[model samples]
Target chain A: MKILIGISSKKYSEPTLDVGMRIASILKSSTTILDVGGKINEFSYKDVSIANELMESWDLDRPGVEVLEWAYNYLIREKYIEKNLNEIGFSKNLLVDKGNGRSEVFLKGVAVKNLSLILRNGDIIEELRDEVQSFEYDLTIIGGSGKRSMAHDLIQYIDSSIFVVNNFNLKQKYRILLAVDDSPGTSKVVKFGVRVAQAFNIEVDLITISKDGDFSEKFRIASSRAEKMMRRSGVTAKVKFSEGELVNTLVDIAGDNHIIIMGTSSQSALTKFFLGSKPLDVMESCNCPMLIVK
Target chain B: MFGFSERSLTTILFWVTRKKWLILSFLLSISFFYFPTPDGLSSEGHRTLIIVLVALSLIVSETIPLPAVAILILIMEVVLGVDTPDGVASSFMSDAVFFIMGSLMLAVSIVHQGLDKRLALLVINITGNKTWRIVMGFVTISALLSSFIGEHTVGAMMLPVALALIRNAGLDTGKATKLSSVLLFSIAYGCAIGSIGTPSGGGRNAIMIGYLAEFGMAEISYLDWIKMTYPMLILEIPIVSLILWKTFTPSQKTMDSSVRKLKVQVAKTGKLNANQLMAIGIFILVFLGWIFFSPIFGLGIVALSGVFLYLSFGLINWKEINRNTNWGVILLFGSAISLGIQMKETGAALWVAGQTLTYLEIIFQDVEIVRWFVSVVVTGLLTNLLSSAATVAVLGPIVLDMGGNPVITGFMTSIASAFAYLTVVASPTCMIIHSTGLITSADYFKAGWKLFIISVILLLIISLFYWPLLSL
Candidate 1:
């Protein structure tokens, strides 16, 4: 089996890449590491100013390199420590594209004046679109740092099938909770999550949270629709419904669950306050690994 | 149990607060007929309360049409004895309303001519496929059209195209919505900056111009307005584009070489869009007329000429033209303007202005500085909260009455007038964008706060240096 792991060049990249490469080796699957960065022409003075500030704060020597170099170093160091995957079984090649590609050496090689160039949103999207369209990986692993802000909001806006990585010990048995919403995007998530559940032979429970009173009608209707989706995916999932408050219901359902998968949709600032912030609140409270699929 | 009980109580409380306007209106009607407020409380406070309650009542009714809601507010104001019948009737014809109506009509003509699309396409094409470049292109183009044509029209023209591109890219609908939302916000923000570029971009600009007309020496011609505004558009758009792109780029790579290649490929598809080209020519001609010819000729007459030419040339049919014009918006403009005029006529705005200075004297001490501070902060926040035109309509007379310096007031109003970046519903362009499922109300508020902060800094710079030096 081929599994592709994608990580950003920031703080969480090393641990995520190490963990991912280790798991790929144990499974004896071919692993590919993709590091995302601003293209050479894509950087800008504004971006350099921001990047330099962050780099200075992090005590990193290379402040003006492509974003991919940070992730590449993590992957290389982890490979040296193990000598297990890179040696006998698993193959490692630094995948770099003309657009969305990144490498530690090349990133470190960049100068401050050159950092002002940055790629377009469409280019970044196109790079990912081409990479995903070409690759036939069974699963695409994503390394997400929990720092919440406008940056996370931006990432969520560009890619929807994201898996936020967090540290938690695996149990003998896994309890997976999928919080379904009314959006059509939920259908893709249900189909994807079911496949993962079946692969692990884990029991999957589908849940929907409705607001109290009249608005609950939308949730009740959505819950029935979600049930049909789960059944169609060939998963005999248990369906649950609740009302009262989003945070309370989410926290209660999260209890004892191995992993909780929730869908975050694109919302206006007002609705995001009402909708998107719940997952962040849940992430803070729940010890269980929570995955927010945007 | 506690959580459940507390949740139920809170839900009940929310429901009550949401429905309070209806409850308050009912109680007020009873008090007016049955109990009545004491004569001591019968002054402007209760009348203002009634107006506020009545407006809230209109907003609360989902089943009622907005026009019907406005009618209800009018009726309640009359019945509740807030305004005399003559006063109420006359309140519908405020200067703000006239300015907004005339400006929107001109904007619709531009829209009908297909000018907005042509300009938008030109910008996107020039930017190539570079992500930041495309964003800058979209922002700049949208800003130019919106500033000259009308912000809402720019949003209407660009949103569909942006959405179509995302869909064509074979991207996720949710992600597409996010990017589209950012694009929409940028369009709105850009239009806002652009509106200040010309006296006719928005009603408020015209209102400020009208107020300055009385000053004789306080001159701000169309070309001069453009000169002042274009620099602001240039300054903010790149930063907005960078911030938007940096904040929204996905975690997993979705963009590839094909996407960049696709941008080049998309240009080939641009050939068949001739209506888009005609639209561009008509838009530029009208824009030129507005900037250059209108000052020598009459603005309304020149604007109507463009409308006639577009119609006669079959650039837009009557049906397309009518639907494109937002009559509801026209009514809102009229109603707000009338209210503003009434306030001016009643010397209410002057009274408010006097009270405002008294407070400013205590805080600011220096009258000239207070005047500058007042013009920047009040105009900025009010225009951001309300419609820019409405802010001008209501506040224009008051600013004029301040009698310190017409140039200072004019520059302040113009600068503050462009500061509608706080909420999605604050401006017509915002509403147009918010309605398009591309951007959510929360998305605007989230990014808008930052933009608002930047705008404040920009306003401070303008008031502190740009105005004092430029006006002199």
Candidate 2:
């Protein structure tokens, strides 16, 4: 499987990348880190002027050189990203295309490619949309806050399943929570979650939103199918049902869970007038990371 | 939720939200049809007035897409019998609309060619990195380029340059970074001021020229336009620059780092590619054509020819041009011209002009200065409300009839219309800059009023001193 990990800004934390690295190594899959740098137009004089004073050139009209230089030194030479890559036993290579440039990094246990994209002057969402559409990825990872948490808004814009990670702890074992509604996509979400949990050698605790007496005959049928799907992967699963405001109840139960997997609602006609998609709302006010699948 | 696909529901919800705005515009427009044909209006004038009112509501409320509103104007004109179908078609498209379309296409093509690295290299080299001086650097480049290439193009070209500089420095956007505000506004206000400089600067200027000739006046040459308005444009630039510099006092003092980065960025391109040189060559040719042969070829023809040259030279591909060029804006512009022409032909413009003239006369009692001032004030205000060109289209005939030295009246209307400072949608240039998401409407209003006051004073001085010196 191939995964696209999104670094919202250049100043991303190690944990986000670490999560991708761990998952990739565990599954022995290909991981691509897309580092999104804001475009040239969005930057002020101060951003490009990081070097002491200014560097004056007479060559006139070439672009991508100075930015490439800055990214090289900042991300590679300064050992900013290099040391981080080395710590994870990843090999880095300078990737250049004529005047424009990026870097490709590979980890030992899995195939990892690093790409730096500077948007210049367009919507980051659109840029990501185009990038994702350009290739196929099973899932995409985004940090929980700032532009990365844009994973919330991006749920509608992108096609792949998304995992918005907040306060991710590599030191702790991941306890998976699969939040399901008796909706069309619920069984699919649970199936995908179970596969992920099986790879990590963990169990998935399936939670459903309902009035909660007997977990409903239909809910039992849905949960039974999901448990059987996990059993196919030799993964154990448990089920719990809740009777409260969906987002609040899920967030409350997510404290002990390291990752929460939720099925996306069928996006009703009135959804546009409302706050946000159910998956994003749960992701926003939650205690841990969330994986949203269709 | 049970049967509908998520995508289908999203599409439905999108249209439903749009329907809300469309419904509001529809109700507001129909409500005003019973307004009993204001005292002096002809029946056609009343119908035209009803269309204008509806157009205004749609534009202001923005319940539908702007292109839809443009189409609505054309449809309303024919349905209301303002003109024959053929007449409406001919009226919808004019040299002014042609110029706007051609120039906008040209702008998108130029930006697509990625020449801003060269522009950035040149600017940073000259500006020497003091943030304010660098802001001035962008100001000078934007204004100068906009004067010839038009603001939409200049604004587009400059957007990435400013963003590169800002993001390179790691400054936050959305008002947290004053430097971001200054750099972006310099482009916005620079485009605004320069757009008033020549006929090529904006669609409004060309539309005004078309109006002057159509309203039965001696033809105003492109150079004659430069002589009449360029000085005022020059005068406004410093005031705009000062206001931007003052209002967005940069949190950082020096931009040496950004300049250095820009220098590196420029160097990365190595040497100019063939496409870059071809783009430059094409722009110079177009600039010379607009300047030397606009009277013969028409500015619109010259601009459209330049677009063909770019295409033929293989400097840009058809797919790229198609993606970058906004056909909707072109349609909107054509409809504006059509609407303006209908306003003139239907007697609605004269009636509106006469009523306005009466009110102004009552207030100022036949003072010539007050007439010009009113023309400037009313056009300026309207320009900020709608698009500058649309404002000129609506007001051009009305003000031309209010009567004074036709050139002065036309110049005041055209030049002041470029002051789209207060609102994002006021000018194409402002809207383009706003699309960058670096500044807010509050930022516009913040720097705008001060410049607006200064501009009014400056215009008064120009009317008193500059116009007479030029024998207007």
Candidate 3:
């Protein structure tokens, strides 16, 4: 599996890096950590590049390189990258221009299967969307500082399962709130939930919700199958059936303590765009981190 | 639902969201096309205005690439029957467009020579260790150098000097501080105010000169331009420096160690090499060509001559110039200038100018003030939103048609466009400083409003009390 992690700054992205790295280590995913800088308007793009070149001559890094260096330090500290590789340090000279405003540096990984750092400029959604579409990553992870407003675009446009690491507090132990439904996506969602449960070494609260307190046989069967999958994967699990609304019930149960794992809505993309999907709605309202499996 | 896959549908939806402005512009243009032409306007003028609206919205929104917008303007001019293909093509490649293209290449060729270290040493030696003196020196040197060379070239060269000083001051170069803000704004604002000093200082000045000549109004020689605007440029230097120092005054009263460290660091690069000398000598020849021979061989050809010399001397290569030059800007400005000429030919500029005077006369009650307001205030504000050259190109013909002395009005519009102090998108120099991550959008307004007001008053004073003495 390939995972893409979007980071912005040293101060706000620590938890995102930690969470993304931990999951990547568990899944042995080929991971990329990306930093998106401010958009340079086209009128001044060439001029700004000229200035950036001058800055380099002065032995200074361009705008986004510092963030990549910080992420590199994090990798070294966590030993996610090979120890000997840290000796050379994070050099801006190592950033290879892959064109279309993307530059990357490849690194040998200790835990993850393959690792690379990418730097891109422009609107966050467009850059992330382009990165995901071009790279064909299975999962794209981002921090939640400003993800609430972008949740719709992230879910709608990005061609990957999204993991928004929202307000993750390291001290608080998190449980997996694996949301199960009768949709066709629930099987894949259950499999991802088991991997996450193993990654975090946490128990799962397998949730099945209905609007009118009438849980259909298909919903019961889907929940049973998810629980069975969790059991087979050696993940500790508990089953809960709720009757309010799907987004409200899940957000309430996963309040600040549980990492919500749920399948993307089976609604058509056009419908999901005009009226948001359940995962997007939950992502907007919920306070905890979430993984919306595609 | 439309027999497409979910991924393709999402991709289409994403494109729609990203390019909503482009869609809206097309719809607006189509709707406006059916509106009856106004009383003073011809059918062709009406169509030209439609194209203008579409181009403005697209350029400001930047929903499409600039080159695409340029091509759209050319296509609309012919399709809308505003002009013939031959006329549009002729208007699209003016000497002013050549100047913009040549100057952009010249800037690339010059910057590739790496004279920034020499520039750094020269600035520090003149300024010494006092923080205030260094700030003034930066403003003075940036203003003087950018007046001769283009502002983007000067801004690019000056950034490293400012950043090196900040880094040597024991501050984190990655972080924004008052020291960094003041020093950086010095370069940005200094380059901005200085751009009005000469015709070669900015592309907008060339565009204005082009408009004046194209409209058969007046001919402004390169020396004549410097004579009219240089005094205002000189006056603005201290004012800009003082405003920036006051707005973002750092706690470090003296950058003693920083200056010493920067001097040592720049010293390690050694003295000016042979290539650097050849580059400077070629640039001086270019400046001399502008002052002495521009009238004989237009400013565009003279600047191109300098680029030729640089290439012949191997000071820069075609590959480097090709890589660094902004071809899109040249295309867009070419399109904008063509539109401006069409505005004049189709009587669109005259109609708009007449309507503006008729409406604004009620509030200001004076035609002169209305003309001045449109040329200075409106152009100033729009320059902050659109690019300065684009602002001048679109607004130039209308201002010239507004009944004042065309030289004064055109010159005022060009000078006012340099008041790009309010936003990062105002000018390339502003964006250059902003790319360092030191100056925020709000930080622009902190010092920008003061300089904006000051510059307007200064330009007014020069126009009223000083410029009449030139008797142009």
How many collisions per candidate? 41, 29, 0
Q: Give the range where candidate 3 chain A is weakest over 10 consecutive residues by summed lDDT.
A: A144-153
User: What lDDT tens digits, residue by residue, belong to model 3 across residues A197-294?
Assistant: 88889999999988999999999999999899889989999999999988899999999999999988889999998888888989999999999999
Residue pairs clashing in model 3 are: none
TM-score of chain B of each: 0.76, 0.92, 0.99
Q: Which candidate is the best by DockQ?
A: 3
**Candidates sorted by TM-score, descending order?**
3, 2, 1
Q: Name the weakest run of 10 consecutive residues (lDDT summed) in model 1 chain B.
A: B250-259
User: Is candidate 1 or 2 superior in DockQ?
Assistant: 2
TM-score of 1: 0.53
The predicted structure with the larger TM-score, 1 or 3, is 3
**Top-scoring candidate (TM-score):** 3
Best by lDDT: 3
Q: What is the DockQ for all candidates, taken in turn?
A: 0.02, 0.09, 0.89
lDDT of 2 at A219: 81
What DockQ does model 1 achieve?
0.02
For residue A23, model 1's alpha carbon misses the true position, in angstroms, by 43
Which 10-residue window in model 2 chain B sums to the lowest lDDT?
B167-176
* lDDT by residue (tens digit), candidate 1, B354-418: 77787998988987767766677787777655557656756776777677766667667766777
